[model samples]
Target chain A: MNRRSLVTIVSVSALTLTGCGQAGQGDVDNGDGPAEITMWTHSAGNPGELEVYEQIIADFNASQDDYQVVTEAFPQGAYNDAIVAAAAANDLPCLLDMDGPIVPNWAWAGYVQPLGLDPAITDSLLPTAVGIYQDEVYSAGYWDAALAIFARQSVLDDNGIRIPTVDEPWSLDEFDEALSTLQDAGYDTPLDIGAEDAGEWWSYAYSPMLQSAGGDLIDRDTMLTAEGALNGPEAVDFFTWFAGAFEQGWASDSGTIGNEEFNSDEVALSYTGVWNAMDSLDAVGDDLLILPPPDFGTGPAIGGGSWQWGISSTCSSPDGARAYLEFSFADEYITEFADNQVVIPATEGAAEASEHFSSDGDLRPFVELSQRFAVLRPETPAYPVISSTFEKAAKDIMNGADVGSTLDGAVAEIDTNIESNDGYGF
Target chain B: MTTDSLTERVVLRRRKVWSYTAMSALAVIFLFPLVFMVVSSLKPDSQILADIGSPQAFLPVGDISLDNYFGVFDRVPFGRFLFNSVLITVLTVGFGLIVNSMAGFALSRMRWRGRSLVLSLVIATLIVPFETVAVPMVYWVSKLPTLVMEGGMVKYDFGWLNSYHVQIVPFIANAFAIFLFTQYFSTIPKSLDEAARIDGANWFTIYRRIVAPLAGPAFATVAILTFLPAWNQYLWPLMVVQQESLRPVMVGMQYFFQLNTAWGEVMAYTSLITLPILIVFLSFQRAFVSSVAASGVKG
Candidate 1:
């Protein structure tokens, strides 16, 4: 090789080494002066949700110079796993958002610290918006999502079905009659009960129906077992009805979990979240009717909780993280989040400020439904195991397995997992 | 023409036509998915679902626009992600070829103690799944020393949780690549190495001048093999790299799968990422095919 070429190679190698050597230095936290507190969110592609968070971060950054909160967003599907990996590496950020039900598990695992905020800030928020575990607040959410029965008034009127109101929801017999009438009127499947969804939705959406039927995910009094709670007589009856829906062709697990089927006139009703209300409103206009879930034996119920923010236990600057968390709770930001994400605001003031969630708005019914009937899932660290077990058992029952045996198997699995984890700190 | 000659000619013609027809049908079947993806990318979500039951799904006939492509760009940092994937993939492929080939050369050609044991151990690692070792690997990488420039001064730090090197360095020394290289190198005659050494060439010289040049198929096979896993990495990158700018195309796929999935945008993003890989494979089609046919390596 020529001398000039060799010199060129050495120089280029040196420069490349220097560039890589200077690429990434961990941002240190000295507990003083513009601490770069990092935050993570599960909102990578949801532009409407992410835009509100970005504005909040920008405002908080510009408000003061003591701390600068920078955020990273991950897609929701991978967010929990990412957090767990980061925690394993001991590389977790100062602040992060978690699903409501997971806050307990994370707290019990020492991934998150107890969020210490003023009562004035938290007292105004809805109970479901506050993630409390072991009687200590671990996270708080700006918005809460509610489940409702999405229907078209025209379809109900054509089928001679009475329009159910929040004060007096359809009784168990009336609900069955409505489903029968809708099916007899030519709707292929009268209801889309989100049977197609798996994982957490099984416990979140259908367990609420079980609660209304006088059975619970676990005995909340002890928080240690699922034997009697999950496989009791009422629970068996609820599962029987759940399976009969599929057998009788009132609901099917074949369709996509969206408002498309209901909007396209393939189903007369949809049991879905507030996230679908915007599309339903756009498609059905004034004919849309957001009714409460049907009343079983106990009362009408729906699942509660959504994404919430928390401070990591390893955060060096706890006060700075608290400042950002506190700043994010303002009514205006909450209203903006609700307006953008089409969810219920956490506070009445924020609800009043939201365009779609206000008193006279078309989606206002979701707020009342969330207020009256939303039930948080089992708050124990064993909740994840319980959830997956219930999902499997429910799916089996829906597909023709004997309800009694399925429920017994689910209870056995839950009991075994809880015992294996030593009751998961119950 | 004689009657027998005419019959034989006609029979050959009919056989050739039948073969061509079969080939065309197989080609269409293979191309169906690609055609569906490209066509679906131009349509809306509702129309995409609605057309699935009909022949219109395979045709670009309804509610077609560039809206989904635009939505993809708006939703993700497409350029940044693609750049990261290209940078990481190229570096891994380049460094992997050199490292694995040298290791293969030593194992196959060099006479040393514990050589057989070392090759066996290297092959043993192939059975250990990546997911099994991923957690420990993450922990070790987070504690490994790293050089970084801070405040215009060079310094040392630990933890490689979110950088380009974190994604590239862990994947470069692949066991399967080394095994393929060693098997390929063992097939070459040792006489060439002896001849090169008689001319006063050293081990490195023999490796560079004699062995590497004649192992083109192995090199091509290793390059393509390394390029794919490096490009399509999802879980490891999702676990180690938190920065969006450093994410790969596979990890970017999760961005489109939120509660209400944007099906069209997903097809568009997939179509975008698949095009580059398709081009690379097509460019190296001959060598790749020959190498696979010889080595019997299945990806």
Candidate 2:
């Protein structure tokens, strides 16, 4: 061909290819036209979870024509680092999944948007879940799991010990007796307390112990005065008992043990979240039994409804984001999502779907615990600092340091952090 | 030999034995962590914490398994992450060497007005931390128009704010690379350039044929340093690349640990990510050593 004809043909081909590519790209961004929306999530969720989410997006696209959501997952450990960089770059995502403690920190920094719930959707949500951040709803959570103790029923039964039932939960004395019995029966690890793991074990395990002993990290009415709440005699006694268990070889020195240890019958008992039950039982094959968190006469163990979702302040489509949140709260979606994810629902109607709990006997304890004694973590800006102090003190006490003095020192550090940050009250 | 001479030889032998002992101890101290990582990668997750500080604990008390290695791929996108790291490191080193060398050659050899001023400005940028410029640079990149295509369509979406370009391009012409190249280039004999010019060669031809070839040792030095920082980069790439598909190995490793929380998988992934870089260094140690020695002699 002549040079002129060749050039013209090449140009036509290029134009057609570009047009086709544009059309394909447009299909990704809501089928209406080309648009972009960014999403950020913590890395803990399985990548497999995205398959379900993609299907949801496809269904949403089929139903309507607007903006499309492009999801991005960040490592949980480096999420803060990513957020800081994104803020500096002015390229933050439209939506983000933040940890419960980090929500206030991000909100106060004006890095997240305060989500005003649709009145229709808000009416269905549990009041406690909706008003977590402040008067204005900052985020919505779909699935939640409580931190609870998982025990080996066969081991207890073989030893002629009756385990706790829903009507008659084990008292602190009864719990200790069980641990002592398991140890005397020659089990190397009778209890798997996570004192050695970083702040996580204590945040999930010991903090509840403190609450069950009738103490809190901070008083809701007067947040600065953690002196009585966190460092009280009840807290000291609880730590002292926990340390004694470690010293007696009822628990291992390593605070971080695998869930398989409990499931594999290597350890008789372990403290962990309800989400671990399915995997744990699968490994051990049904000799497992779930129990209410051991009480200390003050109340049941204090942990519940722990995951949260928030919108990034940089979101270009807040309305579309809210619609997604509303859809997550819908009854059918919530029931399916919660059942598949193995978590408690955050909304009222979704919670009533617990009638299906009879299908899995192992899930009954979690449902019962959620109903009777689901206490939320103290949602405050000082929570991270308080959690760190508690963890440090717990570690020191576990290493055979004086429990009373350690509690006092941790309370002092927490109070100082709170006072310095002017994060005194709710 | 006299009795005193014999006694002195015995003392020297003892001293030699003591020195050998100390060196062996130092070697163990330096190599233990790596040994532990390899051994742990072969262990079950249940055995990791129990065997942490004890080598005996890692001995094959049970059948060894490749579960951890399989877990790394199953739980995280190891293959994609490996590709991303390779792409970023190769592009960064390849482009970095060329751009910095040209700028360095110009500054050192070419006599232009305000040459010192330009060199000084480049040197000054080395002191300013990249963190301070990150936000402004992202904004500037975001505002750049998408590259246009045929029929007035914007084919090349800049998505520069969260793309490979943002991670690799901002760093391609690094200040330190330029400074190193300039310092090394200045030491090259002006006679080479003069000879090339006398042979009727242009400036571009002189650079490619005469100058760059003569500065092989300097280029090797730049490549070693530049390749390392690019390979080990975590924060900047993490900031720019939002999609997991685009994440480099370091970010991928972080995600792997978060999702699995199994130390065995962590060790496996860590070993996988670091092994290639370690092999590269070991393979090129002689050249790397010579480059350093040459730079030192020149300076």
Identify the leading candidate in terms of TM-score: 1
For candidate 2, write residues A145-213 as lDDT tens digits: 666678766788988777887668888888888888887887788877655557555775678777888
lDDT of 1 by residue, A213-310 (tens): 99998999888999899999999999999999999999999887677898888899999999888888888899999999999899999999888989
Model 2 chain B poorest 10 in a row by lDDT: B141-150
Model 2 DockQ reads 0.24
Error of 1 at A401 (Å): 2.0
User: What are the runs in model 1 whose C-alpha is more than 4 Å off?
Assistant: A1-27, A30-32, B1-15
- Once fitted onto the true fold, the runs of candidate 2 whose alpha carbons sit more than 4 angstroms away are A1-37, A43-45, A118-131, A158-162, A222-227, A236-257, A264-266, A347-360, A397-426, B1-75, B99-159, B173-215, B258-268, B293-299
Instruction: Looking at model 1 chain B, report the run of 10 residues with the lowest lDDT sum.
Output: B147-156
State the displacement of the C-alpha of residue A46, model 1, in Å, after optimal TM-score superposition.
1.9
Q: Relative to the true structure, how large is the alpha-carbon lDDT of every model?
A: 0.88, 0.72
Quote the positional error of residue B295 for candidate 1 in Å.
2.8
Q: Write the per-residue lDDT of candidate 2 for residues B230-296, one digit (tens) a residue.
A: 9988878766566677778888767655423777888888889989898999999999999989876
Please give each candidate's TM-score: 0.96, 0.79
